[model samples]
Target: MARVCVVGSVNMDLVFAVETLPAPGATVLASSMSRSPGGKGGNQAVAAARAGADVVLVAAVGHDDTGAALRAHLESNNVDVGGVIALPVPSGTASIVVDAQAENVIVVAPGANGHLSLSSPRLRDLVAGCEVLLMQLEIPTDTALAAARVARDAGATVLLNASPVGADPAALAQLAEVTDVVIVNESEARHWVWPVPHLVTTLGARGAVHRSAGGETRVGAPAVEAVDTTGAGDVFAGVLAAGWAADPAHAVRRACAAGALATLVPGAGDCAPDDEAIEDALN
Candidate 1:
């Protein structure tokens, strides 16, 4: 099994379900509202664990009840939380709206997540010890780059998800030098930060595409009735990393299946599908 480390952001997701997404400046009533644990980092970490990876998370949450609850939740799910730190700020949060068709819009407030700096020696050392390092744009760019450099130096394969967009060039270039794989969606693929040769692009209902030095392979997603589109990408990343060490080809297919299953539920992180669920979906 591969040892995976995820260093990124953690947040509480406040979600509203609606019949249709409102146009900009349009006020509409929500069908329902709920809360869940989320954040690209948190989602990927939990997803990897559920996908059967030995996972550790390096992140910071606010020193509040929400943070504590989240920590306990991840711990219960079998992710090592020793790398998670508590900072003196409000926990990060995301306000999300999902429509009847499961399309979503989100706004994030990075509170304690902003306090996670690149200076943590512990973080670098942790990355060095892992077989894989998974990261995202939810954290500071410099920190994500630093972790990648350390993990690469220690011979760990680095997988970066170019998401939540808007990454600056310098960080993107540095990451390209160290990253083994870059995962993105169609829109994100257009904005490739680094010229990484290895790439995975998720194409919604069309499935996902993986490109490498040899050629490209496309895997079809399992058909499912989507309840919420949130966290589908995260599930794909997690499943990809989890199966990568043992079987790259099968992993990609499993990843697509897991992502499809994720859409059958709402929220992220804590909602990742289990192995049994993934296998069932594939059947």
Candidate 2:
């Protein structure tokens, strides 16, 4: 299996299901509420593991029950948690509101995620030995970039998913310099001009487009009714990272299928499809 290292955040998601999202300064009641393990880093780690990759996640969590549960959840999903550290802070939390259309609005409290640092030798070694280093913006941008630099120097492929947009342009540009492929949603794609070797823009149900020095290619997604769009983008990025080194186009197709499948279920990490399920979707 491909070995993928993820340097990002981990959070416990508090989800509320509502008929419609609240408008600005408006109050709304949710029909139901639940909690789940999520975070761009954790979600992508689980997604890659399910897609048959050896995954290691480098992140931090609070020294609390929520953090313990989050770590256990990742372990249950087959992700190596050796690099996960517990700190004297509250674990990260994301309050998500999902509407009937599977669209969502999320607010995150960084908590311990804000304290993640890549200063440890063990963590640096972990980052330097992976086949692919996957990252997101939920954590400190400087930390993510530092990990990317270490991975890039060790001949590893770097994949950055610049989500939740709003990253410092100068820092993002520096990250792009060391990244092999940069994945983003349509909106995020327009947020910055990436200087990476490959840029992949995910188009939701329409699929994704990949551009590189060689040229550009587009792939279509399988049709499916979305139950909840949460973590679908993470699924795409993780699945893509799992197979990208072998075949870029095929990886995009698989990632598209896996992402579409993710919407059939609610929540994030638990919804990722395994290799067989993804192949079945493709067939």
Candidate 3:
């Protein structure tokens, strides 16, 4: 099995299920409150691990209780946490509001995730020996870029998932140059600097478009009512990385299938489906 390395954030998610999202300064009572382990980086790692891959997580958490809990969560999911760092300052957290429709609004505090620089020995070592290196924008851009450079030099397939909006176009292009695969949502597609031949744009239920030097193909999503869209993209990227690690030719197709399967469940990381479930759905 190919080894997967993820360098990103690990956060404790505080979720509130409400009837509706409040307008500016509007006071609305929520129906329920919940906590879950979620971070773009951690989510992807767990997704791949659950899909039966040798997954290693390289990220930072705070020394606070939230960080400890997040670490435990990852370990419980069978993710290799040998590269995780717990910083003494600024623990990671995400405040999420989910409406009855399962629509969510989130605000994240990078806390220790911002402190995860490429200079860390833990990150460097983990990146050195992986088949695929998965990264996201939840961490510092410099750190993300640094990891890309390292993974590229080390001859590992690098995939960049640009999320959370704001990013420099020039930097995005530069990062894409080194990435073997670039997965972006429809909204973020305009940020790419290069005319990538091997790029994927995820378009909700409409499915995804995969373009490369040879040609392009559109993978259709199965018609299914999605209870929660959270982590759907993470599942897309994670499964894609795992499949690519196994066989690059079929990565996009397999990932699109897995992403569709993820919509069958609810919540973020908790919703990611296993490989058999995805294959069953696809077949």
Candidate 4:
């Protein structure tokens, strides 16, 4: 299995179940409420591990109970949390609202996650040793760039999942230079000007598209009843990184199938499909 090291944010998600998304200047009541461990980085790490990869999360949490539980959750998922540090501030949090259709809207409060950076020599050593470096935009862009540079220098593949894609153009371009594979959704890809040779754009329900030197290939997702799409994209990125090391040709397709399976449940951390489940969905 490929060894993946993820440098990104870790947040506790406060989720609300609603019949539909609230429009602007409107108020709605939630049918139910739940909380769980989540964040783009944490979700991807769990996704990779469940997909049968050796994964480590290099991020931070607060010195609070939420942080403790989130750390424990990652360890329970077979992800290495040795690199997860503790800061004095509160743990990061994401307030998510999931509609009946499983689509969601989220707002994040980056607490200790904002403190994670490449300043720690421990992080440097961690990124250098991994076979693949996976990252997302929830953390500082400079930190992402630092990890990408270190991993690229170590001859490791760098996979960057650009979500909530609103990074500075110059900094984003620099990160793109070191990134070996770039993953984005339809909206992000539309405005993505980075000249990344290898890119994958995911279209919800419609499936995904892969663009490379060999040209573009489209893969349709498995037909599943989506319950919540909170972390489906994170699952896609993680599966792609793990599968790329073993079977690049089928990785995207395998990942798309896994993503579809993820939407069958709610919450980010628990929704990631295991190897057997992913295989079953793909078949």
Off by over 4 Å in 1: none
- Residues 257-277 of candidate 2 have per-residue lDDT tens digits of 999999999998688999999
Model 2 segments more than 4 A misplaced: none
Model 1 gets an lDDT of 0.87
lDDT of 4 by residue, 152-240 (tens): 99999999998878899899889989988899998998776768878999998878999988899999999888999999999999899
Q: Indicate which candidate wins on lDDT.
A: 2
True-structure Cα RMSD, model 2? 0.7
Clashes of each: 0, 0, 1, 0
Write down the TM-score of every candidate.
0.97, 0.99, 0.94, 0.98
lDDT of 3 at 118: 70
lDDT scores for all predictions? 0.87, 0.94, 0.82, 0.91
Structure candidate 3, residue pairs in collision: 197-212
> What tens-digit string does per-residue lDDT give for candidate 3 at 96-178?
88887767788998899989987876678789789899999999888888898888889998888888668777777777777
Ranked by TM-score, the better of candidates 1 and 4 is: 4
Which ranking of candidates, highest lDDT first?
2, 4, 1, 3
